[model samples]
Target: MPASLSGQLVVAISSRALFDFEAENEVFEAEDDHAYMALQQQRLDEPALPGVAFSLVKKLLAFNNGGPGSGQRVEVVVLSRNDPISGMRVFRSAAHYGLGIERGVFTRGAAPWRYLRPLSAQLFLSTNEADVRSALAAGVAAARVMPLSRQASAEHPGELRIAFDGDAVLFSDEAEQVYQRDGLAAFREHESERARQPLPAGPFKPVLEALQRLQHEPGMRIRTALVTARSAPAHERAIRTLMDWRIEVDEAMFLGGLAKGEFLREFEPDFFFDDQAGHVESAAAHVPAGQVAAGIAAG
Candidate 1:
């Protein structure tokens, strides 16, 4: 826990991005040439990693608490090589294996190619010195090879230090849609008047519950927070929602109209997840961030 994993960079990358998932090519005599091809294909087709490691990736991504000012918090990273072709292939095939393929670099390419033009990181499973160096230069903290093999836990201070956004992230998008359709004043009035009511759950609540379980686990690491745009009279519902959930968030802030990036830099979270591009774009600069898509709401 070391008081804080901040004052340092944190990142989330894919496993294939770090290690070569495909078996190395081997040289053999011609007698079993066909067999070799089949074997290699099988390896590529089923490059199953240890389930424990896979769970670790989820655990790390699920950790929302961590900030620069907070006590020890390791920056979580998901190492992923940017192979356009292979990445494309993986996306197309992911559903066949019952894996969830949410949008992002691997799915819809959130950080468009143009945005990444400045970096020379390799496009495939090549975690070579050049790729690593380029990624660092391009602003990736510690790179993580995604898809861990087992369930794992990242230890932080007794405090879990969770952080989240307001609007669609915490409450349902009904309010946000009003804000987008109407103006700030109207949105404020609506939220202010509706302060006593409960908001519909956001996509991350179940995941938040999972984190809460981890937080309550004996000798476990957990802390929580609510970082939102709602402030003053309108923020009551948000606070009450947490209470209703029975979750103990160590630090909660209502930014009102303040920019989240600056506060996020100060917060230094282990990993921050949001559904909006603006927040994630800004927070990614200071913390390991994941953009949970809106599709999760369908569940």
Candidate 2:
């Protein structure tokens, strides 16, 4: 039988998203590709530092260590735009950090999101917005990783914690637009009236489902939280939607417009995902953060 990623949770991440390449990226932006390639070649032996999603990827990969006959339950592939030569450093870096990432697709400068389908990736994370948007358009769960976001706490080495916003992320932004246009009262009334109706799925729904599946596997230690700004009546719809999907998150925080940073700081998630730039900015200050640039708020 052919070696396959079937029955495995696959994640496709760009080199920049997986490691700190800001300085190298600066050269790529200011100079030409040749200069950037030269820099990467110069430091080929030096392993790059971990970036925002590093902890999340590391913890998720730990699920594969169920021993001999257990088989691999997770796969992390480097889906980068760097040339094959530059990709050498990426693989080296992963090895240096003890990450067992062995698969990759180096596209030089071409879009790498095209490979997500073949990989059966439930998640695609990159520092490049264009790549993320392309992956989303292709029906893959994608998020633009906040490269400078705060690193996750090292306190919980054995557990993986992830948090996500509700509207525009786990669910469609239909209700979010109403809140943005009208006042709070109108938004609450609208949500109350539509409480029975489940919100439409958002781009992150597929990834959430994949995580839900992973959580059920023996020896997998994963915790998920829904941290949304909706309160009271509005919260009912979001809860109902999850109930309707038969998905259960470990925790749910309906902040009712409270700043999410402090709450997330205490939660200490390996990564947090939100659609609004403001929320991402706040969470990035306290935890590793990624932005889902989809829906009306993203516009």
Candidate 3:
């Protein structure tokens, strides 16, 4: 058979999401690709500092160091908007950081979401909003990485920790839409009544499902959490939904509208995903965070 990424947890990440190219990103935004390419060549030997998703990427790549999985095989591909020449620096930076990323697609300025289908990427992380939206529309679990977000600490080098929000992230925005259009009381009441019904799948559902497979890989250490603003009566529905899907998280935090930053600090996740930009910004202060940009709040 042809070389394939089958039966693996495949992730597609952008050059900017994997490395700290904030300065170069600005240059690309203000000038043209030529200027950006020139700068990359000028600093060709300088390896980039790690970006927001670096820790998550590094940990996921660790699964491949052994390379055997019923589903633990992990492949991380660089799906970037940078030119082919600039891609050299991306590879060099990954090499410098010891990330074994061998596959990539450099599209210069065009949308890179077009390649997600071929890769069958379970997750797509990028700094570009348009590309992320396109990936979500195409049914790929995608997130707009917060480039300026803080990187995770090296306190736990042996395990990979990941977190996600509930409504509009792991679950559909139906309950969230009810809360937005109505009020908290109504949302709780709506959820309580339909507690047994499964909420529709959100963008990150596939990503979580893929992680579940990777979690069972021999000798792999991965932790996942469901941190949401939900609490009590409304929270029952969330739990039931996960049970309905037969998926379980290592931890679940129903903060009931409490600020999530400090709580996330305590959890010390390598990365966290939230659909609300406010929540993403809050969690970014304590842990590496990304915005899903899905549902009503994202608008």
Candidate 4:
């Protein structure tokens, strides 16, 4: 196991925040086998997420399959308690698609996972408020019990820092496309021209908002970073945008084509997410990274 995963407590989250699982009626309908099966068939082609959330899920599946770091040192738990109606279906679909989540129970109740006592990364799928709350509470317990953060001056278990790309993760990608299509010079001119304009909603907006609530918790178990390719003149949009979104991102880095791998190395992020392969390639080397495929046209 790598030092990053060693003695670390990490959990990846998936909910209405990252994925719109209830978009189709068939997804929730019990009678439409064909529609449901067709939906199931589409899981492989599901778009990648913009934060480490997706990678965290994949890593969780890997851990479930006995990949590595499967002892008392780490623990993996999936909490689909958020969308009580859809959590089980999503878990079942993942298992049906061949991601071995052995001995996992799908229930409408909130239950502490005694089975995940040992593991580096703990992946959780939370849909219910109680479930998500439970997962965070468990995370708090892990920070107190984990060995990794024992010597660190910080009072938390594993720190559990998460990194995100701003444009897509925090605010809508409506303006991002303009920047990409028009190039940096034009993008900056446009953003500087419209810095105070209201920002559109992004996929993680709600999740970020939830994090803000958690941020105020007596002892927060998470920290976030917003790393974007946008530079100075275009920066306030992100700052003000986060303000408008009301989510607190602890560290905000606005790099103009600067390599993220180095920053990720120093930040020691538990996970990082970017919409571009270029960024993911670099960051993945230093942190547990994943690509967000939303808003990206199919290649």
Each model's TM-score?
Answer: 0.50, 0.96, 0.96, 0.51
Q: What would the per-residue lDDT of candidate 4 be over residues 1-299, giving only the tens digit for each residue?
A: 54334433344344332234545433545655456445545653454222223333333333333334443222334433233334555555455445433323333333533323333334443333344334434542111111111111222233546677876545667777887788778888888888988678655565556445444333225678988888998988778877866567889888888998888777776556565667767876666665544444201
lDDT string, candidate 2, 99-160, tens digits: 99999999999999999999999899999999988888888888999999999999888788
Cα miss at 234, model 4 (Å)? 0.2
Model 1, 1-299: lDDT tens digits are 43333332233344343233433223223334355445444445553432212333333433333334344222333333333444444444333333333332532223332223322212212123344334334533222222221112234433334466655555566777766778788878887887767788765565466566556333336556677776777778787777787766677888886767678667655555455656656666655544444422211
Query: Candidate 1 at residue 123, lDDT?
Result: 22
TM-score of 3: 0.96
CA displacement after TM-score superposition, residue 197 of candidate 4 (Å)? 1.0
Model 1 TM-score on a 0 to 1 scale: 0.50
lDDT of 3 by residue, 183-277 (tens): 99998999999988888989888888888887777545988999999989988889988998889899999999998999999888989999999
Q: What is the Cα-based lDDT of residue 190 in candidate 4?
A: 83
Evaluate all candidate structures by whole-model CA lDDT and list the values in order.
0.47, 0.92, 0.90, 0.51
Candidate 3, residue 247: the lDDT equals: 91
Clashes of 2: 0
| Candidate 3 positional error at 139, Å | 0.4
Candidate 3's C-alpha lDDT?
0.90
Better model by TM-score: candidate 1 vs candidate 3: 3
